[model samples]
Target: MNLKTYQAQTMAQALAAVRRELGKDAVILHTRTFRKGGFLGLGSKNVVEITATSGVNVLHPTEKRELLNPSSVRRNSHTQMERKISPMPPRSALEPSGPAGRDHSESISSTNRSVSSKDYLQQELKLVKQMVQELLQQNRKQQHPSVPEELFSAYMGLINQEVTRELANEVIEKVRSQLGPSQIMDDIKVRELVAETLTKMLPAAEPITLETTGKSKIIALVGPTGVGKTTTIAKLAANFKLRENKAVGLITIDTYRIAAVDQLRTYANIINVPLRVVLSPEELRQAIDSMPNMDLILIDTAGRSQNDDLKLHELKSFLHAAAPDEIHLVLSTTANQSVLLSTIKRFSSLNIDHIIFTKLDEAVGVGMLFGVMKKLNRAVSYITTGQNVPEDIEPGSVGRLARMIVHPQKGSEISDDNIPSIAAGEIL
Candidate 1:
């Protein structure tokens, strides 16, 4: 039994050698290729290594039987025994399998390799892919362009009507530069822009806040559904009652939804404030006018769909009855960028003075913030994070908003130092 190395320019030549010396039962140990380095006119030569193991013990029974113990054989038997040996063809005399077999084998190997690669990448590339995808999404959302929406959309034929990052940024920056120094626009620079944009859309609030100085204020919170209007109103209520010592009254214009009034009523209970459920605009007006001894009036409007002009206008009739002194437009930063913009536009005509940016934590890109303030010229009064009553709401200004937009690289939860690494140069 012996192990031998065979070198050949092609696999067929090497395999033939193995089959010839070790027969059809022979097993291939290993195969590899090496190439020299070269450039331009230089050509690198290729070399192959084939390890072949041949032994009667591990081979066919015929080969094993051919081996006999010399000690058991007599010296005269070699001359006396004249056995006729059969002649057989060797592998060096046979033809190769040709190129078609080689190509078919390679195709089968490639298909199997691709399936294996999927499993390998899924296990090893999870974090790396997540990081790259996050970054790519961020870049696509942030780089706004200044061209007109129609022109920009025409150039690219995007199905999503919202302005792309390239176009949005271009327009926002152009207008921002024109804005005089008085406008405090940080990264969410869009706040100031939105203020400017909305100013043209909405008429001035009909300056008639029914201010009853010393008495408890019956304030109602109102807006379309899921804008965090009810929750924001609660926060405002807590701030007024606890911080300002203003006796606050709660009223809901959201009797249409089953738990709408119940939700606000629960808030009223938490703050130890009394709440009124008004089903009609007339009742809504009557309830607020009746609370004449109240200091501030916060009215809650039903969540109206932006597309429902009739319903929104109908709701406005109720709001118009009370003549809200400070109408805050509560916009969610996590909302679709187009929806947020349209809501601000639609609500502007209804006498919205200030905007509240909710769910900033849920927002990954500040482009909408920039769009609302700088591009649209809207004023933001505060930002609310989580749903936790007063604990989650904060008075947001340009400084904090700017910091969030400018520096977006947040630290990873896993410490870099804690990650294990292979020893230097210890690679596969």
Candidate 2:
């Protein structure tokens, strides 16, 4: 391998110099920019530098010879196969004339080495081919050619918002396809179309209400640890019982953490609602039956680690006993996209009806939530912005969430301030 460095005023010039010296097959090792020819760190000129290498020897002599001479290689392979099947006669029995015998032994030894090298080369070649195929496939699926500057801004905005590249591309492509040339020329119109398309992609369910005419609704909050499940439940409890004037009861099976139980108990006391702490699945059943007259029973579960299958299954057993009407899989908006997906997959054993995203206020970017909602295909019911009870929670809306993800500067446009507040006397 030969390595060389080139410096020029611009990247194009530096790249050209590298290619001219190193050839088209050159591999770029590094690139950097620096200021030079300046006195006292003033009036410095910027220069682009590139380090490149070429003539890298990748193949062994034996492998190259075998690749170029297929007939001789195949003949040698056949001879090897026959030798393996039928062992060679003893040296004393098959000994040839002195010089010829030595030559035959050396030829056999060389052929053995060649065969071993061939096997190794075949494996390496297979791996290289697989890598090339994968790279080609990825290239095919990568984003299309650059769009006009106006459209490119929208595309990059989505990416900056943490939206998946594939999804962002799809959104841009959809907008491009639907709009006419005249419409496309207007950046505002194009951006609005993109936002509208993203908003429509998010599905939201009706808010859980205890005032319904149907049978008493039982809702369970489940999620991985530190996702704000207990706090979210407290918010929901306050909204339903204190704010909605409906009979609401609380049940918690999160005995694993003493703090968790105390937290829910504190919320129940503040909200003036009956609270039950059960130990086992049978106890959970009893807790459900004991709260028959309650308009709604909000169950708070322990925040189990998604990777702990045993604990998750145990949690599922409790859920099986209660058989709640709604299982709200609580997730934190600040969580990494991969962790959120793992949590969802782990908790999927129990039926999930709605998704509750908490800590939206703390999230740097909520665009990953778009991918999560789309991939899970579960409707979002509520999104909690802050720690304030009942104040920070809002009924999930497709338009609100989509707008937040696509254009985060616009605060959640869905209004909850005017939502009717319930009378305290009704809870007693």
Candidate 3:
């Protein structure tokens, strides 16, 4: 048997070399790809290697003839039928203890080796095909021709910040479409255009506000476990009672956690506002009715896991009973986009009026927030930056959120006062 190995820049090239040297009858034993010729892996090029063998007929004469020509097999079908009928020999002749038996055993072993080699080749080809597909997908993502070179950095920035590629492309494409051939070359102009485009995509920020008819504004906060719902409730309560000097009432249905109830009670006492701890949906309604004179009533419910259907059902019952003027779903920015989206989808049945993003200061990037808001088309009412009551929380601003998505490094530096004003009519 003759065995040889060949290497080339591609599988096609490598196989061409194998066919030239080993002929068409050669059997492939193995194949692999590796990087070659690079300093510190900087300029490496992919090389394909193949191992093949020839000069060994692994197939029987009839099988080889059938494989080489299908039409011949149909023409010789009668001969094949005769051979199959006369295949059996006497037991002693088949099991002869001599050099003949040894040659028969050797032939079977060679056939087995050929079968094993064929299986190995098939498996390697499957893996190689999968790798090629993955490389093609990565290349398409990296070299998306629709995004120009000038906006490529901005596109990558959005991706690194955890924005979905689809959304990033949408924003970049919008920027490209708006900018002229000359403006695309200007880096600062491109950045500004990207920011402006992001700002336009955002829904208008609608913060909690009271009506002029002296009617009480009932607002409730709901979310999943450990998302700082209680703390956010305190911030909203304090801001209304202490800062705005409006009559504020605090109600907590968070009886599941004694600590959460106590925490809200502490804030109620500090802010010198009325506090109600309700157990059942009936009591929740009664609590809201009892605080009719208050200008703003902030209700904080116990955190329920999105996956817990029973708990979510109970939460919905409570919200239905309260029937608050606004239902703000409080979400933490620390959670990833998928989790955030899933939570929203689960809680969507509650008729979520707006979104309240908490833990903004702890988030690695606010881009996911932008993505969620854009995808859901939900408006943000408030954003909590830290743990400080009334101080860390602020009304949601589209300009501020857009700037953070565009310039993550300068997110911490952006403030309500410094956020560039976006025209209301420009909102998408």
The C-alpha lDDT values of all candidates are: 0.54, 0.72, 0.74
TM-score per prediction, in order, is: 0.49, 0.63, 0.65
Q: What TM-score quantifies how close candidate 1 is to the native fold?
A: 0.49
Candidate 3 vs. true structure, TM-score = 0.65
lDDT string, candidate 2, 1-428, tens digits: 56687877766676667667766555444455677897998988877665556644365466456644545555665444323212111121111112222123334334433443455457678999999989965664465464544577788788888988878888888888898889887877876788788876667445775545746789999998888888988887888776677788999999988888898999999999999999999999999899888888889999889889898899989999998888999999888888888888888887888888899888757788888888888877877889998688876665566566556566555343443332211110
Off by over 4 Å in 3: 1-143, 418-428
Give the lowest summed-lDDT range of ten residues in model 2.
85-94
Candidate 1 vs candidate 2: the lDDT winner is 2
What local lDDT score does residue 35 receive in model 1, on the 0 to 100 scale? 53
Q: Per-residue alpha-carbon lDDT of model 1 for 1-428, expressed as tens digits?
A: 36667666665676677677767544333444555456753786554445545442232334223323212212224222111000112222122333323222322222222332343335447878899989975664465334333233221222132334554445444545555654433323444353243233322212112344564434334445797888887887787677666667777778788687888888889887768788877897888877765565567778888788998888888877766666677788778777777877787777666667787767645544655665446456566777988656665444444434333343111122322121011111
Stretches of model 2 off by over 4 angstroms after superposition: 1-143, 146-150, 411-428
**lDDT score at residue 140, model 1, on the 0-100 scale:** 47
Positional deviation of residue 378's Cα in model 3 after best superposition, in angstroms:
1.0
Can you give the lDDT of residue 263 in candidate 2? 89
- How do the residues 49-84 of candidate 3 rate in per-residue lDDT, one tens digit apiece? 656665544445566445345345445544362222
